[model samples]
Target: MSKKLSFTVKLLGVAGGVFLAAFLSLLAAWFYVQNWLKTPLQISDAGYVYELKQGQSLGYLANDMGVAGVLNHPRLLRLYARLNDANKVHAGEYFFPQGTTPESLLQKLIKGDVILYQVTFVEGWTVKQALAALEKMDSIEHLLAGKSSADQLALLALPVKDLEGWIFPDTYSFSRNTSDVEIVQNAYRKMQTLLETEWEKRAPNLPYKNTYEALIMASIVERETGHHSERDQIAGVFVRRLQQGMKLQTDPTVIYGMGDNYKGRITRKNLEEPTAYNTYVIPGLPPTPISLPSAASIKAALNPAPGRALYFVAKGDGTSEFSDTLDAHNQAVRRYQLNRRSDYRAAPPSAVGN
Candidate 1:
């Protein structure tokens, strides 16, 4: 009787183990089925654009999308997300196609694959021009549509009075729904960081008393010539002029002082009209930067090319001929400026960063 009782207990234990195994197999099959079989997304040919903001929940989005007829079953998606450990997703604009499944959409979210939008603040753009471009981008949420430069600075928490020459020039990328102020602040910080780096490595005995002053010179160089080869040359002439305590007499500075009323030409009357930006009359660095300087222009200003040349005239073909003497400079002016043949292929006008 004892042997029979022990055999019976062993048989019961074996049956329970088989039952548990079959239950687990069925559960595993169900998990896979729920994860793989999802309703096709309802979207048009243009696709659906969904925005996921920072700190938003995927479960909530799944339900929201379900109500919008994009998903047939939200609970299944939420369950699959929990089971597959794919609950986290990046914040950005997501583009979903008509036939996209819940599994695929969740995969994209988990992998942090979101839509990319770009905004460029090119070299030589003024704060106003850059602001205009930022406002025009459909991808970025606009913030500075009617705000003045002072208003923009206040929004960015910048201490300066003007936002003119402070922001860096580059093709900046931000996630969809990013605010314009965020991009502006980022660009300003990038410019500050890079300018400080270049400032620390600057050549000795530069005319600049501060990093801002060097930035001022760089903006001048950026607006002077867009040519890659002439940045240092332009920087050299300006540095030498500053050292000699002579008027910069640069036409761009004069044009900037003229404002929007300048039309297309600069006259003797315009040049003589004294303004804070008129380097031709100011006898020193402008109070603020004239344009957004490129990295190359900034470097050139900090470590200007070696020369004693104090004068430069446009060669009408995007080049400048430098001169150490007033007489030589006058000759270049006659050859380049007086001759109507002068294309004066000036860089995208430095005054307004056009």
Candidate 2:
């Protein structure tokens, strides 16, 4: 019995030794992987720009990187990823700057640290202009091609008749393979959020009954002024007009209604054409906004400058002349718009000049 017990003890000791050896080998392998991850890639030898397209897997990237000398072996990367709980690479263009490590590269790809491309939507651009600008971008995915403004709005779930002046004008950043619709939706959401927020804070008894009307007024103001300081004053004029049962009679609204038919100039008959957007003939704000308004314009619409001035005209030097009385406005129009010599002017207020 004592001999049998000794044999069992020997067997147990051998098993434990084997287990210890295996554990030590695994520990050594773990240390080796960590060290391998720290080593910089040979990507510098090749131009250091790496572009990964959509639907690509980490395994494929590993093989590609190995071929580019960015990784010593694809298998090592796969094994390390499996062991270290690293995520799959994301799709985008990547620039591997100097001293980029395997670990850092993996982190960048897994965390989607892709290089960002930019698209700038300038203020006062019409929907047509905006769409045209979008079509020129090479990086953005053309998901919105051939879609009409109404269809685009339908995609966004907004039941509007027109797409003009809805999207916020700002610089947007995006990755490769990002949908064009996504960018438009992003800008629209920003506009909606801003409009709603401004609507909540609007001054009491303003003629604007809802956020949409405010947006319309804002777009008109945006087109009317090149100077930022004039937004509130111009908005105030429209607001007072709406309240006093007078037509806004803004020329920008008339131009928008004219669409492609608008020549370089507006005529008396053009103002009298009586389209839905012709504010000169229409009783209130246009059915929709006319252009992409800036945040300042939207703000001005909500918080219009306190004034009694009901008339304004372009001063031809990137400014405007505001007057409380039509007679005063006519003289200013004669001086500014018509470029006529005025001896403080004498004609009666015609209710038409500007």
Candidate 3:
């Protein structure tokens, strides 16, 4: 009877040990699953959305993130972000949910969702005109106010004395709350990138002193022709004149010097007037670019077509004829300008001339 009692006690001890081990294993598995659920997962949903304003506090962000299902606990999210030193969140529209883990929310906040605002700078716009257009943008105007033109130039990281030629003509997308400095910097950076690539493969014997000079010439080319097919030919004529040490004698340069208050027509006296940007007076490139040039015009300036053409004149139609000799140019001008007075009738009433 004593042996049987001892055996029963040992059996009960073994059973208790086995149950305890099983309970421990189950607890470990449950802990692992909890951790796995909290881990950041790249999930998307149509209902998730959030907005982060400039200077929004961490508490406010936490509340919004919680409502949007981006965080399980607002307090936890704030604590985690603060503990990890993740407080520098830029202003923009964000889309997320409370189901999003703390790690994922932190990552999204760090990588700001910059809302792209499309700004189109048309070809042939002078710096003043460009600035006027920019001023119409409330955000840009707000940033530019109280800032001098010199300050603006500095913001763009331009080596030049002004930002006249640096703002590249293109359709750019910027954040709605983007500062004027950032907008200008983006344009200048793009211009620099384009110039670097084009300058490396520029045509042989081009007379430009540097990429800026090429840009200046390209602005003239852009203003000269609205026809896409005529850019190369017009570029060729200007390039030839430059190589021959002749004046550019472009009418657009004269118009540009007149400023925004310029009257309807460019008179003969306007061409002779001396100004820093007057191509008619200056033998080489103007002191600065007259207008914003398109990418096509820049390409034309870099790789002008091979030709002996020195002169060109608008043929009343949407195109111009090129000439190798002054006599040919004179004849073409007489035919296009003298006899084509009716063709150059006043611009249509509905048409707004730039």
Candidate 3: segments with Cα more than 4 A from true spot: 1-50, 53-59, 64-91, 95-111, 139-141, 146-148, 155-157, 339-354
Give the per-residue lDDT digits (tens) of candidate 3, residues 1-354. 699999999999999999999999989966864574477533466535566777786678778656765555677666666767887776676666536665666677788754466777777787767666677886453566556888766656667786776778777777666776677677778877887788898988899888889998888888888478989888888888888888887777766777864575655465567887667677887788878887888999999988788877777777777778777877777666643332221111111122
User: Which one wins by TM-score: 2 or 3?
Assistant: 2
How far residue 184's Cα lies from its native spot in candidate 1, in Å, is 0.7
What would the TM-score be for candidate 3 when compared with the true structure? 0.71
TM-score of each: 0.85, 0.85, 0.71
Candidate 1 per-residue lDDT over residues 1-354, each given as its tens digit:
699999999999999989999999999988877665565677778888888888888988888898998776788788878987888888778988877888789988887788878888989888878988988888887877797767767778975677888889999888888889899889999999999999999999999999999999998888887478989988988888889888777777766777788677665565567899877568888888889999999999999999888777777667777888877877776667653422322221122111
Residue 166 of model 2, lDDT score? 84
Superposition error at 95 for model 3 (Å): 5.1
Give the runs in model 2 whose Cα sits over 4 Å from its true position: 1-32, 45-47, 51-55, 339-354
Best by lDDT: 2
lDDT of 2 by residue, 1-354 (tens): 699999999999999999999999999998988888898887664447778887887888889988876778679888878877884678888878777788888898888888899888899888788878888988888866788766777776765666778889999999877878888888888998999998888898898778888998899888887579989998888888889998888777878888999766666676688799987778988888989999999999999999899888776666778899887887777677663321111122243333
